[model samples]
Target chain A: MTEADHETVRSGLETHLPRLWRYGLSLSRNPSVAEELVQATCLRALERQSQFRTGTNLRAWLFTILSSIWKNQLRAEKVRTGGGFADPETELVFDGAASMETNNLLRRVLSEVSELPEAQRQAVILVYVEEFTYREAAHILEVPIGTIMSRLSAARGKLAGLDSSATNARKTRADEVGKN
Target chain B: MVSAGMADHPRDEDLVAYLDGELALADRQALDQALSDSADLRARLEVLRGGDRPFRESFDLLLDAAPLERMRAALPDPTISASVISTTQTPPIPANDWRSLGIAAMLLLAIGIGFAVGFGTRSDMGDTALLAELDALEAELEEAEAAADAAPVATVKGWRQAVADYQVLFTTDSLTPDQGGDGALALASSQVGLNLDPATRAAAGLEFRRAQVLAFNSKPLVQLAYLGDDGVPVAFCIIASNKPEAGTQYEQRNGLGIVHWIIGGYGLMVIGDLPEERLNSIARDLRKSIQL
Candidate 1:
């Protein structure tokens, strides 16, 4: 059963790779670096798989691994390589069959989120985007829930600007279309 | 139509939490009523709302862009992955004893010396200046690590971190309501040999709940607990120490903001479920008003 549980964890890593890559992208702002982060996080997870509490939140635990590595060592190494401060929102944004003109509001909001200070961005992604409760985000981020609350509050103050503009843009579009 | 519970506008943080459906039911009802009555509050909420759907969608698009095939193929082989972890991972050696702390400091110094020599030999004779610079830098880091581990303020245990860990368990109900000018404060003060005075503290949204005597290494540790007006638990922890006076230093532990300093032969800390900025402001206020 213990062996089976460990297998469950390894297979489990597959299900979370996309989300992990996304989180890594959010942290590093570079898709390749984010992939590197995901790779390292997975390797670290497997190496210490025994320490995992079997039935608890695997996603949160995986996130804890990814963030700690970014905080402890990967960030310093990235800074030395000039990869630390690189802003690659263009690479990060969706570029599928959907036209860029159609994704204007979505892209603008995402760019605003990406441009927030690291702590606030992390809080915004974890709590608001990933839907982690403030408590869970606090635990994952190794901060008090109050810190998470304040980060979101500050983030809201910034994102609210984008929200209002987007709302007004919608209203203007509706006006042009003769909608009530 | 505003109820008395709507005494003031709920902060943007509360509104965001409410928007996420994460606000405690304790606060939800009051906020719900306030929204129903005040269009101004509703407008504020609207400005903060709508990010959830957009965020999820954008992120999903980002996820769709993920190189899923490449990532999966790149995962390390499970059969031999255990040995892949870095060797730098060190088990935490508890620095509970001065004798042990001394050893850690000496070992770090030896490592520093070894590092300097290893790198010094690699540099050419003309680069002697570079070697000296490297040695000096390593020595400084060694000294700092040694001092941090040996600091007398929290000699036997990570007392500040311990306090933070315990504090996370606090709730509004965890601390029974008390104005804190009572026998409890007096007892704590007597044990700690410092005034556990809430009288001097200006109540700025944090109401004093209780004072209690907690001990570490047989030294009296005073915990003065408060509940934020919005129901977060905040605490001030003090213990007798012979360390020289130091200015406020901020740190985070157990997900709480902490600001600590040494004053009047005592180590003082203010920690809470608060942002670092808020905690710092309160710490600054305490530094001025709470006379040693």
Candidate 2:
């Protein structure tokens, strides 16, 4: 590959390192594995930059690669354990110092999010936390937009029970009314 | 208390999509009209919106907490394909081998280090490193073929590396369970003079597939093929050796975890795409079963 090609893809993927790690941590729930995912994803993006479409969202492309890598590891872990899947929850929790859940609400939200089944958690994080449009999140996850929407609604069905942020919503609405 | 229009009745998916602004324009406008017309609808939408947990700000904490420096240090230098590995990938070798085995030992160490450094800094987390190693490994195949000819003169590590290379070729479909492996295991076990009881075959917690007598350096090397429950391939091999007796040693080789040791003039190994600790435990179980 040309050096210019290397610099373009390398820098683009590098800029998203922390974000990729965050995504990886969400998937694997392990910090070391997240770092491994980032390094592997960078090498892969550089090696296969040819496949990346120019002018498309590079961050989405990189997240897709990171997601692919994480899924493959889970598959390998599946094979390694024979038929049973290893529980990521018990082994390496990403929630230790890496989590800054300072308030009760944030901590509860995180706990509720983390408690979702693997697939729903992924959909929620990509669409909500990372703000991938449902379309882009679907592409990264290789699921249809309908599936993403259903996963999110399913997540919202559970999370919407959190004591409403009604006070904040009311204040914002009052301010809007006053401005109008 | 006005009845909601059937055309505008929103499902939970619509409420979430509305929150995300992901609906098409016409659909969004319909939801907007429905919301403005009904206080109950607006209140329902507000609760869903309230469910937002500052997701971006919260995850950014995780992002900031990433060990960026360490991870950055580990990122491959895009300039050189093999530089980081050449300097960093050192196989675990005992320190005193230079004293006893001399240049032959050193030659073995050099070869181990040479190839290990070529692509071995760390095991491939998945296919990225696997694809790269596949290319590097083909280049080494000829060297392994040459070693096959000189097998009598080959050291344990040299031939084991060859065996490890052969392992990279396995897929989930590489072998089937119980394809005349009993016969081969019987014959090869007899040839190698080890009593691998049927119980020993199952000791590794894997499904037995087949066994074969493979020649290395013109010496018969017995290979026992097996698969895990999910079709993860694993192999237990025995090759005759004249090396001094050694305790079980565990390591990762060419992306596979291997636990090997010398006993009764044979080098025995349990190799698989498993973690080192796993292979080590399997080896321990086999050793215990056999010694009994």
Candidate 3:
């Protein structure tokens, strides 16, 4: 690559690497796997640099690549393991001490989010965490906006239920503390 | 007047748009009014807005404790250099090893041919040639291994320099805009190291709508832009001191890319259509460069 091109790639890579890792982590729920995914994604991007449209959204393109790689890996693993899925409840167990005091409510909510079905989880993360627009998320997920809406709805309903339970539990605990 | 159940609590779809402020003015007004009147709805909105905070904070703490230098050492040396391509291209490998391997393979093939040719006349000659070919193959394998062990450090050095430059830029108050309007200009300057094409650079300038410098890790953190190549930026980057252990993360909403990373002693983000590779490369480079 020309010095300029190298600089461009380097700059772009530096700017986006963290987010890529995070996205990978969120999807794989493992740091090592996320790193591998990011590395593979970068190598692929480097190999197929010519395919990148100069003025296009580089992050989205990379994400598409990462998601495809991750999904493929998941599919391959599924084939190997006879299609068993992970338990959402187990994944939602958060360590209370690991969080800050101010974030107690937030942690409770996310744990509940983690319990959502895979589609709903993706929808919530994409909508809430990534903050993508409904149309844009639909494009990324290759589903209709309505599907995005419904998935989001399901996620929200589940999260709301979780939040209500958490709040109730907290209130009960507070009352007990007051009586003591 | 609508009854309690029918008072328009904002459907899930509308809530998403409302959170992103993508709703039309009329819708926004309605949603805002609803939020004012309904504590439960307001609380729910707050929960959604604050959903990722713990994750971000946890990731940030992890970054603080991570051994960044070790991570840098673990990274492969960049074989591709900047001074040579129209687009991204892999760096060419040294030819000496290939030449030796090729020569050995050819010698082995020739010896096999000789054995076949002499088999009727001299069996001893055939065995001798075969043995010599085997020795040559062994020698070739050793040479290949030795060559493989010696990686090009220049690429790693380049990556280091890029990271260092990013750290310096991120830490020094050189680019922080004094006012909000100047943030777009500041972002444009940050693009200098990125080496984007002029058109892409210009487009980035247009896409950057605002900038803010906030304190992170006792140093300034710059947050800028809402427009992205994806049509809107749902992402941002944070260039801060000391790399985050867990690294950066992204989520896309409404075609927006939200990116957050720590470079030097500051946090940075660039939310846009810019690809993840581009963002990652930049973040990694910055992380490697930041001093303390």
Number of the top TM-score candidate: 2
Which residue runs does candidate 1 get wrong by more than 4 Å? A87-91, A94-102, A162-180, B1-7, B37-39, B50-53, B82-292
TM per candidate, chain B = 0.45, 0.46, 0.23
Sort by lDDT, top down from the best? 1, 2, 3
Candidate 1 global lDDT = 0.65
Ranking, DockQ, top scorer first: 2, 1, 3
- Fnat measured on candidate 1: 0.41
Q: Considering the two chains of model 3, state its CAPRI-style docking category.
A: incorrect
Among all windows of 10 consecutive residues in model 3 chain B, the one with the lowest summed lDDT is B168-177
lDDT of each: 0.65, 0.61, 0.45
* TM-score computed on alpha carbons, candidate 2: 0.50
Model 3, span B1-292: residue lDDT tens: 1112212645444565565565667767777888889897787676655433344443333233222332232222344221111122234434222332233223223211222111122235544655465456557645755675775332332221222222221211112112124233344334323212222223322333334332222222234333333333322334334445444776443343445654434445544445676655544544443333
**Alpha-carbon TM-score of each model against the true structure:** 0.49, 0.50, 0.43
Residue-by-residue lDDT tens digits, candidate 3, A1-180: 354544455556555676666665556544444555665566455545556666666777777677776675443553253222233334432232234453555555555655667677766666666666677677667788768865765555455454545544543554565456
Per-residue alpha-carbon lDDT of model 2 for B17-86, expressed as tens digits?
Answer: 8888887777778878878898977887887776667666555556667777655644544433211111
Best by lDDT: 1
| lDDT string, candidate 1, B1-292, tens digits | 1222332456566677787787667678879887888897798788778433377666666777688986775554343232122111222333332222222222222212211122112333423443464345446545854787676565455668657755754555445334344266776767666655753355577777767555444455677778775788888888788999999999988788899999988889999888888888878776676668
